[model samples]
Target: MKRRPRRSVPALLSALVLLAACVLVAVSAIQRILGERAWIDYDTVAATLHNLHWTDLATAVAGSLLALAGVVLLLAAIVPGTATVLPLAGRFDSGVARGGYRTALRTAAAGVDGVSTARVRLGRRRIKVRIDTTRTRPDGLAETVRTAVADRLDRIGPATSPAVKVRVRAPRRTT
Candidate 1:
């Protein structure tokens, strides 16, 4: 299936700012070495661009390329597998969907007898279900909850089995 890219405006802006800053810093250092006559300053260079006194244009071009490279690297580091900035429509709802699935599993597990509490976690690759039973002899409690979870999820999709885990703690003793 073709999945769309997820876009983040703030992240893109931050990358652009970082790129500009890097380019400015590189240009300044190069100018300082080449003396004040160098047209590295943004305003001076823009007004007297026709001067072309030295090969500073080459330095500027190199700096711009370096800045572009930095932006590409930043995007790659932040966006996982994507090397370039990909435009996306809106944020993804995977978190919400996973939460809903987890909630369903918890509710179903809690419905079982002697189930004290159920903590369900659905991960990107798998689903983990933890159930604390009220009795020492949990017996078929784990199997029951596992079956319940599988059945509930069957309507939507199939899950990797043995993923549902039920932990039975010792029964609480009366004071």
Candidate 2:
């Protein structure tokens, strides 16, 4: 089964804000209908709004902030979140989580001979591998790591195979 990306945080926040405003407005209206004191003094608010001028600094700032919030909410609604899982090639039954995939790639890199430690950062189309070794002249180590990572990737069989990039460094002592 395919996995969907998580919802945007900004979008959720905007929805919550709108819901709160609606609830507040409804409660005030209900209180007014009951002939009781409303939560908000509408008469006072109307008078204040009538006296407020566009040239006022407070009015300008409030308008700018509202416009900015609208733009942010619009962008949040339009942009899609990053995928959580990558689908496997020819397999509709399962997919791999990004964390698990990165861990597997790190294991493949570290399994190479002379690799003291391995670090991996994975992207949709790029796999970056960094390895530390003890040997001063770590010749062919990068290629070996790349090959091992590629082999592992083949076994996992992601729908899209990311290009493997390997960087090997020999440990050094600073005087």
Candidate 3:
């Protein structure tokens, strides 16, 4: 009997990692809130609040973080291959700029000879592109993708150098 190959171990691992990360971040935030409360007990903190109360900033911050954490966890759980984008931390003039950048990079990679699909991420200091392609001449395919990404970067002129990561999977066979 022929064995079937796995479809997406890396994707699964990434989602797990993102979920774990979101949990960790939430834990850290909660710990900070608790620590603040304990360290500056109400007896001591009340004086500061009396002088400069700002409508419960601590609760506001904590609530906001909790809400963000919940959203991140929910996205990580529900979206396949979407966890990596859960905590999108950065500055873009608008959502269009961010989406355009991603679309441009993915399109560039997909235009390469053998790439089946592409995922692109723009970080503060670096760009990462993941390409899924058939395992037909892996070395040559990788080179082709690298060249395509470089060309796209030149055209985009983003302030960071893109690190192209290629995942070559065997093409699915049809009987």
Per-residue C-alpha lDDT of model 3 across residues 12-129, encoded as one tens digit per residue: 7657988997877677667667774342244555676577534687867877987987676666556544212222223652222566777887899889877888788766555677
Candidate with maximal TM-score: 2
lDDT tens digits, residues 1-175, model 1?
Answer: 1233455655686679989979887888788777764445666766776765456977688788979977876775576432122222234422224445567778888888878888887654456778887685777888888788777766445323325555555476655
Better of 1 and 3 by TM-score: 1
How would the candidate models be sorted by lDDT, starting from the highest?
Answer: 2, 1, 3
The lDDT leader among the candidates is 2
How badly does each model clash, as a count of residue pairs?
Answer: 0, 0, 0
* Residue-by-residue lDDT tens digits, candidate 2, 4-91: 5755578688779999999999998899889999999778889999999999999999999999998877766677655678788883
Give the residue spans of candidate 1 off by over 4 A. Answer: 1-96, 158-163, 170-175
Query: Positional deviation of 130 in candidate 3, in angstroms?
Result: 2.0
Clash count, candidate 1 = 0
> What is the TM-score of each predicted model, taking all chains together?
0.46, 0.74, 0.40
lDDT of each: 0.64, 0.86, 0.63
Candidate 2's C-alpha lDDT? 0.86
TM-score of 1: 0.46
